[model samples]
Target: MAKQALGPIRRSFAPWDDPEAKPLIHFRGVTKRYGDFTAVDGIDLPIYEREFHALLGPSGCGKTTLMRMLAGFEEPTEGDVLLDGASLKGVPPYRRPVNMMFQSYALFPHMSVEKNVAFGLKQDGMAKSEIADRVAEMLTLVRLQDFAKRKPHQLSGGQRQRVALARSLAKKPRVLLLDEPLGALDKKLREATQFELTDLQVDLGMTFLIVTHDQEEAMTVADRIAVMDQGVIRQVATPAEIYEQPASRYVADFIGDINILEGRLEKGANGISRLVVPEDGLVVETDQPVESDAQNAWYAIRPEKLRVSLDQPADIAVNTVSGEIWDIAYLGDVSIYHVKLDNGTIMRATTANTTRLVERPISWDDRVWLTWDRNAGVVLTS
Candidate 1:
């Protein structure tokens, strides 16, 4: 059997928007401690049905530890975990209604793909006919039916990873836990498999909770992401929300490249943020409102938002800065200009390579003006 191309996705899923959506998995003040060290500290979160949630963070950030608690591999030291309204306390890993796929693929080199996929069903004491049928179904779902006879060594890295995925899905667990599932594949294959995984998850209507340190991977496939750090949950939101409206300075820096400038909020009209960076001689206006009591604010602007030109534009009231182009990075698809101001502050502006030929584009050591719209970036208090 082979996977048939699915029709266009009729509707997008957004369960978090519904007020009545109950959580399929809930972490109720969950905390895990090993000796004197605490890995997860009082985390309360929920995962709705059919939601592809991601636990994203850097290494040693306790993301894996939190996922392990849900997998029943580790028990919480303080709070409890619930799966579909039932407490998962003291439940063994094998008995839980969950399955985990490891990062290494963990395929048996000697076994064929069919046998590897059927291994889990066989372990559950399923009849031979049922095991075969389940294995076939899983192979078809993962688009690996033709490679069922091949051993792990004979298959490509992507194929072997699919075999592991097929085996994991053979059991039809309510929730699938993936621990860095695509860590081994090369970049191209990894990106390809990400879409495949998303489509398959939608096709099967499975709730997948993945743990990964890669920011792009988490953002690409997940409906919502939980960004964790130092045994604490920092921000949990949709990919676009997290990227465009990061909660803190740590989150903004962690997710992508950002240029932060020290600024103070000045009194302005309603719904307008007036920022004065005395150090850099910059007056910035942003769409987001600033409170009168708030102080010690910083302006976080992405490089792509800033437009650079050789001459000053007429619309300087929005936001503008004059500087000399210090450097340029031609990245084929985009060119980044590093502008150095008189106040010894360096800022970056990214311009896309839209034209086939560059006709008098700004170059290194050229006097340039940087401009951005008021709504291009939001004012960040933290």
Candidate 2:
């Protein structure tokens, strides 16, 4: 199947950047506490309409608690949640204009797909004909029209998830809350379904707020991700920004595989900065200026940003390190080389497997040079 066109929406949509633009949902000083433990701290967040946002963190980080507050399932111990300019302080879950699709799917075993989808409308006392038409529309929207007569047990995991999504969308909610909705699927299916969910969210033009611990899933589907830790939001940014320009050491380490070398910053001439690692006698130069006043800092570089080669780079004054290739992981698309530097620090370099060769040119225990551009890594101070 052809991929859906989602680039325009992803690239051009920036309502949060506009001062005049109003958000559909606002979380002002929202805090949820159980006994003495704080699940969610005082947070102020704004989710724009038609935006696909994600609340991502590790277990017990309060990502789910924040989502529950928005869904009206749990009231905040302090602060408030507003949807479309209306406060949702005392609103019940059922009365909220948002629907939640749980990880379990919560499908009825005895009811058919169409009947399961119509359950919400029927509870609202909609006419029979209207409910039938809405069910048909939802089934078609999820491409489950052919399985309308099948029960939940008769469908595959992906199909069952679609049914759950269909039922949730049958209400035409203002916002859709997904709590690890694709957790049941295997790796390959989960990847494919991520695209499907993104396409579906765009097609419906409804706001989506998903909570998940899967970093790749959030990076793939969400327009913006709010990374939380210990009930506090660490950073909120687009996927590219989050990956390329992480705000802190925690965020830099959490999102992906990164090599952090602690060193002291030395300001150089002409917009040049150097990170001097005294322990390793390594001097890393960069074109980017250091904004922080702290001399003690860390230079964070992703594994893929480093270049591995047997030959020493022409310029060895900076951004060049010699190491022995201790290990190599041959993944299908790429190979990761774990090189042990002279200072006993192990850094990884990734190379794409572009051609099929019976024997590899690079192997273990080989003396190699890892080089990177001056602008390849970011200087982080925290």
Candidate 2, overall lDDT?
0.92
- Model 2, runs deviating above 4 Å: 1-4, 292-294
What's the C-alpha lDDT at position 379 in model 2? 88
lDDT of 1 at 175: 95
What is the clash count of model 2? 0
Model 1 ranges with Cα > 4 A deviation? 1-12, 358-360
lDDT of 2 by residue, 1-382 (tens): 3455888878899898999988999999999999999999999999999999999999999999999898888999999999989899899998998999988999999999999999999989999999999999999888899999999999999999999999999998999999998999999999999998999898888899999999999999999999999999999999998999998899999999999999999888889989999887898888877875438999999999998999888878778899899999999799999999988999988988899987999998999999999999998887
TM-score (all chains, Cα) for each model: 0.94, 0.97
Model 1 residue 141 lDDT score: 81
Q: What's model 1's overall lDDT?
A: 0.86
148-247 per-residue lDDT for model 1 (tens digits) = 8998999988888888999889999999999999999999999998988888887888999999999999998898999999888889999988888888
